[model samples]
Target: MINPLAQFALLLDADLMAAALQQHLPECQAGDWQVTGCEIQHPRYKTYRLAENRDRSFLSLVYHLRGRHPAETTAEQRILYARAYLGQRSQQAYTEAQANGETAIHLAELGMVGWRFPDDPAMPWLAELMDSRQIAELEQRPISTIEIVNYRPEIRCTARYRFAASETEPARVVYGKTYADERGRAVYTNLLTLQRQSVAAFVMPEALAYDAGHHTLWLEGLQGHMLTELDFTVGVAEKIPALAHALAAFHQVTPPPLLVITSQQQLKEWLKKADKLSHAYPTIQPALTGLFNELRQDCPEFEVLGLIHGDFHIDQLLVLADGRLALFDYDELAIGDPLQDLANFAADLYNYPYPVAVIDQLVQTLFTAYSAANHNQTDAQRFVWHLRGQLLTRAYRCFIQQKSAAPQRVADFIALALRPWPLAD
Candidate 1:
């Protein structure tokens, strides 16, 4: 009889699944990042973390199908109950492990279909999509072979494909991103539409193909120097203008159809979520809450209901060899106050190198370019408020994600939050 663990891994790549399982349950010492302990209440929901920092932090993946209870008032008790249940499950898994030599996790039991198929040189549908689209970059050649470069389980797969024809064809150098589920499929589809609309106005990846059934998207690999990769102090002078111009042009048009945005109500709900993470950031939480209160108290009117790249940042842009700036990753596209994009970009500037003054100058450069190109006359006070709120939320998230951020960096964000917004005067 085939072990359930082996069967589960067949859907995903075998090695990847083993690496995850091997990290936990000390039984597999082949790698570092050992887990101190883990409770497996079900084959589907496995929770574990590094051996040293088990209490301070841990990792957990709860599948959507696992009867996850709705957000309830008694979250503390519910979390306690779930942890206890996981202990019970772990006990059962240990007993089975002793019976058999080894029993890895059975992820497929939880409804996961990993898309790493090594046997088929090419998936039929993928080939058809490329062929039908008549991808000009391919030079009439077909995708000869492929390999999974990266896979984030239940999220996305980054695959690199080689062309069957002449090696010199630009298509030979290609990378594709495949979504794990239907929703990811729809988002990427929307991205293609937005990309097409921006042509002649913005530099985005050349669309090659969109495979809806499999949720795979192919594009011309720009393979250029990304703005994020450069030292901003050296590159910002030239690159910032191009980025600002592209964004201004994109915001100039009416928002793409069906682009959804969560407005004031969403902000309120997210602030409540921020409250939950308060424990993780005791020192910063006070300032954060104050800004949150300000945002909540003064819900400003949208002077311009314009387009925004909801998740814009330095990393989302590229400085191609041909002296053009390109943008990618449209997953967070939304229709909102255009200033939101500027605020998002400013916050991201902190992530790069250089002194606060240098960062501030770059931001000002972008803002100046934006204002000149688009002629936005939004109220200065409103821009200040919007930027403050953006800094607050960004600080909260930065503290949450990078817990070890320097005290000074957190302080910088707080100061930015409280100070009058840049370009306000």
Candidate 2:
């Protein structure tokens, strides 16, 4: 039996994939751009990061099924949709090609579907926001420059707006985030609620404004380095108690109405992810299926839903100059099992490109501190269950994200999840 995604596997073959991408991509057709990396963005899409041979400037090119297969969007309709956001002048931004039997739409960074608003100057609030008037906390000044902090094509873009220094005030920086849809409004609301609560264990950067028309959210720039920058093998332990306390305090807060995801729902998602992984890496299908079945058989029936940072990880935490920890990226905040946050954080530690023993020590310290701070609310058995589930989820993410040493990491994570109950001392 031929796997439906067998053809897509070619996208991961660095050599073949790069050759194909360079051949079809309009900008790369001249042979100046080379594929630097590629990762699965969605089941039907992959993003190939290309670098120019001269200066090495990066551009993201997405190979997706726009008006194809499951979506049923026609090629003509897809082209029209992209042109609508990018204007008619963007004739060279996308070109279609066949990947096996599928019609794959290759879109350049600026012409990415559903997320062209960030580059659209004509957006209703863009000029005002770009001019730095949207930041009420800062003394208004002319914009000196703008820097794109991070961009995930077809998802979101975060840019830093730096204002020129005035006689009385120093230059200030504010962040603006544009989403593919109205999701930014909800994240803005969550930040507002977090700010009002003022949880002392940590600080949440201020949410400045939300423009529903353009699906953008503005936030005050924070002065901090991400927690991941700290020496995880050494001094990180000292910060664990505070980190644990912050997470505990955050969990107790009454979050605004949000989606409720239970363990059962998560298991269902994992099953789907497992299916995707099996199709992509056929060799692991047997092992993946057996492990998933075991997890399903042992799945916990009870759940305690509460506020959680849906995607909590070390990178999402920042250590401020004043020694306070600031949390960012609340787009995934939801009403779910609080244990999921703890598990998510712990699971992410395994991917840090460090020694397994070092990661194990850090996770143990984190779990100990969290247990103490949360007043032992973490059920021993349930916590382990959540941990195992989170490990599988992280493993799946590692595969799709194309992280360094991904195959080994996925196997290690799955092995850890299958470890006997206490999860090693």
Clashing pairs in 1: none
Q: 27-88 in candidate 2: lDDT tens per residue?
A: 34554344443433322233222222212211233332222222333331111112211222
- Alpha-carbon runs more than 4 Å astray in model 2: 1-140, 421-425
Instruction: Score candidate 2 by lDDT.
Output: 0.65
In lDDT terms, which candidate is top? Answer: 2
Indicate the residue-level lDDT of 184 in model 1. 49
Q: What would the TM-scores of all predictions be?
A: 0.66, 0.73
